[model samples]
Target: MSILFGLLAVIIVLAIAYAMSNDRKNVNFIGIGVMLLAQVLTTWFMFMTPIGEAVINFISDIFNKLIEFGTEGVNFVLGGVTVEENASVFFFNVLLIIIFFSTILSVLTYLKVLPFIIKYLGWGNF
Candidate 1:
């Protein structure tokens, strides 16, 4: 069944991690367990809860707005080249959103918001 395959995949990944780890004696099982629990709970909530759906919808709306903003900038600079009847131009224009997201992420990193979460969550040690 699908569950068996999923379990196998997790085992394989953990085995690979164990093989690649430099300090094999210091494997933090508790941290791994906590992270796995968080992932499972988050997945369950995201798929099975109304509140999670609302949160996802809110984030999706924000992303759509950001993408629209990017498209506007692309249209301004490219002078409607992206709006032309060509798939290539449309694809190129879509990729412009990556630049927008990367800039936002870089700003968050500079402000130490991302690093703070990583440090406090023990993700840095992981």
Candidate 2:
């Protein structure tokens, strides 16, 4: 496992260096490759260990907190009435939830989270 991670780390760094010195197309491919590598490496490292259990718990806790926050916001704006008990209202609530999450995602990405993530993946320099 450690050897695998070490190799992945080396690949990521090399990819970033290549991206910096190569053509745009190669850089793009390198970026994609790095993302895939990061996904695989993280899966191998995190899911195959005891820490994986804690990581899962932490992720669940975060989602729970987000749900609680969303519920509070909805209640505040809708006078605390659970109108989504009806089918139409339920669909509307689902749409609202999707939109809320989408907007949050967009905002975070716009704030350069995506770029930072790519950088951390070590696929590209800038």
Candidate 3:
């Protein structure tokens, strides 16, 4: 995931450079608009239903893994700290829950989730 995000960053930078070089003023606006929309939708979904739980769990899992790794290093230096009965797993579960939802949101958006959202949400009213 980190590698993918790094690649995305690189691609975005190159795209920005190309857009600027081409002098397409509207391109920047469009790019920003898309980003804003994606972020808003992501945030909205973050608060809803089982999807929210899934996303939280996913992120929590990532964090727990990192924390566990650090704890291992700490233990190696200080003769080990005992875990509190599956606490790590619980954290991971939460993280995975969140991440899963977020992943779904990303996939949906990539597949033009907005049209569905708009139609269902009656965004036309706005």
Candidate 4:
């Protein structure tokens, strides 16, 4: 029942994209198919598997570690601050962590490591 609506929505979106594409002949249907399959499989793996719980925990641990690192950096700059009294704590915990993560990603991109990794993991080969 709900699946039918989901399929209809996907079809409509794809139809619109194809209709709007100027170079329709160059559209890679195989790549699109691969992407859809990958998306569905990844979602199923993340939701339906016990390994998903472990993956979630692992990611949580990484973020926790990154937060600790961010806190340490903030403390170095400000002497000390608590989340209760200072907005800087929140800024350091969230925004600085994001900036730090993005910097790491940017470095990886500059090194060409990200594209190499993404190509294999993503729809590039397909």
Candidate 5:
């Protein structure tokens, strides 16, 4: 089964690491086991918990909104421009997002808003 293969892969990787390690005598097995267990638990928590789902959804929503705003700006200027599917239409779309983000960033920097945001974020006030 796939689960058996996954376990085998983990064991093989650990064996290779142990073989290549310079300080094999000082290798802390307890720390390695704890970290592996933490990885598994963190993976499970992210995909299985409602709070994790909400966190993911919130970030997704923010990204989607930003992209939507970018598209709006792109369409405002190039709405009449037509392109074929085999061309660089997708490239232009991505470029629009970057352009919109840069424009906002420049404006924020000019207004000294970025420093305020960075200062508070650095201080963990948010």
Candidate 6:
């Protein structure tokens, strides 16, 4: 049942792409196949390889540290509002962390680090 739905979704998306294409005859099937193969292999290695696992863990650790740092700042400014008894304040603090994350993202973008990473991930063209 899940597979049937997934196939249907793919068919619908392909149909949409075909309809939106301006020069369908100019499409390079070999290039599409190569890109698809690269995507599949990259996904497989990212999930299955030891080095990939280590890299994922490293990134997770960095993210957790950043979250902790943000929580500390929130606690200092909001003072007791983020306690377990104050659910609303805690939720607000979570939302506030987005500002900190976005600032960091903007700085990285300005430095071209993010664009380099995106290009490395095969999503640079956009």
Task: Tell me the tens digit of each residue's lDDT in model 3 across 15-103.
Answer: 87776775665456566657657766886788776888799889999878866665555557547545567477643435545655566
Ranking by lDDT: 5, 4, 1, 6, 2, 3
Better of 2 and 3 by lDDT: 2
Q: What is the lDDT of residue 16 in candidate 3?
A: 78
Pairs of residues at least 3 apart in sequence or in different chains that clash in candidate 4: none
lDDT of 1 by residue, 48-120 (tens): 9999999999999998998888878777876876355555553566567787778878998999998998788
Off by over 4 Å in 1: 83-91, 109-126
Candidate 6, overall lDDT? 0.78
The candidate scoring highest on TM-score is 1
**Residue lDDT tens for model 2, 1-126:** 998998899789877877688576545766567777777788887788889878988999998887677767777877877664445776446666666678778987999997788778775443
Candidate 5, superposed: residue stretches over 4 Å from native: 1-48, 124-126
Model 4 TM-score is: 0.65
Cα-based RMSD of candidate 2: 8.8
Angstrom error of the Cα, residue 96, model 1: value is 1.9
C-alpha lDDT of all candidate models, in order: 0.83, 0.74, 0.67, 0.83, 0.84, 0.78
How close is every model to the real structure, measured as TM-score?
A: 0.77, 0.51, 0.39, 0.65, 0.52, 0.65
Whichever of 1 and 2 has more lDDT, that candidate is 1
Model number with the top lDDT: 5
lDDT: worst 10-residue window of model 5? 117-126
- In candidate 2, list every pair of residues with a backbone clash: none
lDDT of 6 by residue, 22-84 (tens): 999986767766766776698788789999888889999999999888777776777846355
Model 4: weakest 10-residue lDDT segment is: 81-90
Q: In model 2, what lDDT does residue 2 have?
A: 100
